[model samples]
Target: MTAQAVAATTRPRPARAWRAVLRLHQPALFLWGVFVTLVSAVLLWAYGPGGNAAGAAWRRKCTVDLCDWEDYSVDRYHFAFRFSEAAIDFMPILVAAWAGAMLIGRELENGTAELAWTQSVGPVRWLATKLTVPAALLTAGTTLLVGLHRLVFDTQQVPKGWNWSDNGTFEANGPVAIAFPLLALALGALSGLIARRALPGLIGGILANATATTLIGLAGPHLVPWKISVGDLKQGYEAPSGAIYGGEGAVTSTGAHIPDPCSGGEKACLAAHDIVGFYSEYHPSSQFWPLQLTETALILTVTALAVAAAFTLLRRRTA
Candidate 1:
């Protein structure tokens, strides 16, 4: 064999950073796999047996004005759906906690991350690997769960399910679920990088993500243009079916929207304000995907910022 060929054969292979990250976080991966499996099973059950049984029970037992509370089938299916949805919704925050405590913080706290840095992997590459691998997995898993959730919800219909405006339902219905968990992961990374200890990172991750989430939730309805519906004062105001109510008020001749002059429906008060018509601003159900995607975009934007900050912090610390 030639010397070059012998040297090439003898050369050590570069370490697989991603594989190391995976092996280190194997327990988390296993837990997530179990969670996804159970949630998928629950959702599938809801989509098939649970949905059919509830629908039939409702029709037979209490299809009238009032539903019978006796049959456990309705309650069982309802609880399962609710519980499953809640779990899916909570998974992101849980991801945040895990990412902060285990993924980044624990490594740094134990000097393992620094030890890895002394190896061939640079800090930037290490942080990037730490983020991207989990992010891809999280996004794919959450997206599937969201799809299953929507399927079950569509099959069950209303009363059994919820309106699009419903809090957890709305979030779980779209890319928001996928994006927000990435955001949570990013926030957790930032927290871990900042705290450099597992316990503090976990707490900081949860609080930071919670704050960001609350802000996002508060701003969700206004992310897209609100459909303004106007009607003559003589006729009461009405929004489209399955609309997310923004606010309602009196519309004057100048087209100015103002709060209700008489909330109690007092005729004299309505006349005193020169209320020519009533106006309501809402988002129709047709805008579901638009609103969802917009919110996803917003959350992803924040996630990008968090990840950038984490990188910047690491760079400065290493430098």
Candidate 2:
């Protein structure tokens, strides 16, 4: 081919490939856009107007001596915060379903993937295109949402009954927010490749994501070594903000013992346990990045493994 012809063909190949992918997934892309827009609006409202109103009302009614309990706006903002948090928590499952059912599984089940293989694009290239395009979009969209979420969460005064260390809060406030979605995409692709059916793949992918998230949450405290603090119960000790308490127990001259919640009295409880002081093991606020990065690395490793498995499965089936 002539130089102009060759250049024209090569340039159009990538453009055409991208256009095709976008066209095929228009519905998914539209929904993703809608989701991002709604979430962004919610976060902005929470930080700007909703939070301001709530804070103003709180300051008006609350004082050292007494506080009002009849305001409904407080409850409204609280529910808004909760709803925002729940949306963040559900992202992984949504990503998994989309990646599995819509991205690859349906194509494979309907024979569209095989037909695409007969075109200029081979199976490997097709799979790579499918994986990379959606992965990039998912990463960008989720990162944007996370940034907004952090802004809303950090700027607002936390409502009563909310803890920063809550599971959804911890995940949404850090790098795990981005990593988990990537992991879900990889897992969903693998599930789709294995099941070769949209519905089955979607279900399997959701289960995989759920299992992984639960395991990580359970192991989060132990992922990084925690700090320990000891203090005399009589003297009183307070944990720092954002501390994840592993456990609190009695420390005595003889040995350590489990804490007792006795209704009788502090003296009676201490005497029964031979406890002289209290000790706590915890991960503090300073450990947040360390813990978040460690968890991100772990989830990314699993994502890599899943992606590798998917490619292997594709090669096998095509062969």
Candidate 3:
């Protein structure tokens, strides 16, 4: 073979393969760009201009006194925060549908994947390239958004309704934001490989993502053991901010019981019900990192299993 021919034959192909994957999904890429831009703009506005206006309004209305709510801008700021949070919650479904239908299922359904197999790329490399490129893009975008959200959330003084312990707030504020999308991508790829049809794969992927998120939410608190705090009812002990409230009840002679309607003062109520004090089980703010890391590990484990299953199915189909 000539020098030019030998050089061409020996050159690397992974870059070209990745470029082809990007080229194949240009529309999805464009949409992702639009989403990231819009989200960043909203967060920036909330952190700078919107937050300033709301703060000014609050100070002007309340000068060591309860503020009248006639013209305060707190509600507007709250709306922006709530809207951003809703967008973060919705991103996983989008990732799942696009990864399943556009990235893999359509190729298989239309025989383009088979055509690509005849080219320089093998089946495994092709699948890996597809998953890797999109995963990288998704991780970068989501991490940026999560950082921006934390900035805005931390700087602003929102009402109790925007508590960090809320489900959406907790997920969006931590590493779980990034992990969820990765998990959805893997689940979508696996669903696409199994279904081998575009529409069904898209539907299956969304449903699978929903089911996984729901299960995590239902089981997350149990994953890490919670702490119990006991205090006298007369003293009035309250859980710290950002603590996840498990349950609260009075400790009575008959064991722990939820407080019922007891008449009279604290001493009278205690005497009437044989209640000693109040005790509650909760996950405190100190547990945030542990819970976040535990959930992220669980999600990433599921993601790894899905990716493995996808590869196994691909190999069997093409063998």
Candidate 4:
């Protein structure tokens, strides 16, 4: 009942909990290390020699209004760049699947979780440790990869082969890349808790994350207000550089918008629709950070909710 003894008893053993989690999941941790290492190596190569060779080839090919179609120096860099992008893009799926099948699912299925709960760990701390460790690992690995990917990408290319708004490129270039895997981790942990079986947890986690991913992709363009570019009848419409195009249409003098009235140079056809101008709607380059941050916020919000739900479910079950 002494104050010193009471304080000692009350102090949290986070290190103990973390050590247990890491020891139990050492295989997964090793695999993740390998994954990050391999990805970093390829990306570093692409960021340096690969990028320089491609840039030089591109420069050589574009000068004097003439081009060398056989210049193959760009191929190696493109392969590395594309592979790295694809890996990061699919990272959420991989993380979710592994978390569901291995992290919580296997433990629950074999009664290991109950064993831990009985050993004074408790369900809430257990689940928190499960989520926290992986989230930290994921964040670090993704931040490094995203930084390297941004370096490997050539933002200065004329005509921009891989635009910032491109699907894989967009995800790999910002904090959303980091947020997505965390979201996936939450989704998988929740799914594992709900299913309490390895196989079903694996399937449910991947499907749940897939659904969220698709929804996010569909909502990305709408996250930021569309900027419109309009041109008079005497001129044509084209979006500004670095803009992510949404749609286009013809504009009437009365401010009504409609589809293009003609494409065969038929002036009378245009007049029939009362079209007096054309317009393009897009997210301009300035909106890039806004869009990226908005998506990251949305994803992290869901991630927090999922983690909360997992804890709630665990507490209810244990109580």
For this target, which candidate reaches the highest TM-score against the unseen true structure? 1
Please list the residue runs of candidate 4 whose C-alpha ends up more than 4 Å from where it truly belongs after superposition: 1-15, 60-71, 154-160, 234-236, 258-269
Question: For model 2, which pairs clash?
Answer: none
Please give the lDDT score for candidate 3: 0.84
lDDT by residue (tens digit), candidate 2, 106-218: 99999999999998788898888888888888888888888887887778653465656777777888888899988999888888998899999899899998998888777
Q: What Cα-based lDDT does every candidate model obtain?
A: 0.88, 0.81, 0.84, 0.86
User: In what order do the candidates fall by lDDT, top score first?
Assistant: 1, 4, 3, 2
Candidate 1 lDDT by residue in tens digits, 1-319 = 9999999889688779989988999999999999999999998988888878887888776754678577777777887788887997898889899989999999999999999999889999999999999998998888789889989887773264467777788888888888988999999999999999999999999999999999998898889999999988667797887778898898877889888878627778777888788988999888898899899899999999999999999999999
- Kindly report which residue pairs in candidate 3 clash with one another: none
| Superposition TM-score, candidate 2 onto the true structure | 0.85
Candidate 1, TM-score vs. the true structure? 0.93
lDDT of 4: 0.86
Q: Write the per-residue lDDT of candidate 4 for residues 1-319, one digit (tens) a residue.
A: 9999999889565448888888989998998899899989998887777677777887767665555588766777777877988999988998999888899998999999998898878888889888898899999999999988887675433323567887798889999999999989999989999999998899989999999989987888888899999988788686787678987889888998788868524789888888888899999768879999999998999899988899899999999
Measured with C-alpha atoms, the lDDT of residue 156 in candidate 3 is: 75
| TM per prediction | 0.93, 0.85, 0.85, 0.88
Which scores better on lDDT, 1 or 2? 1
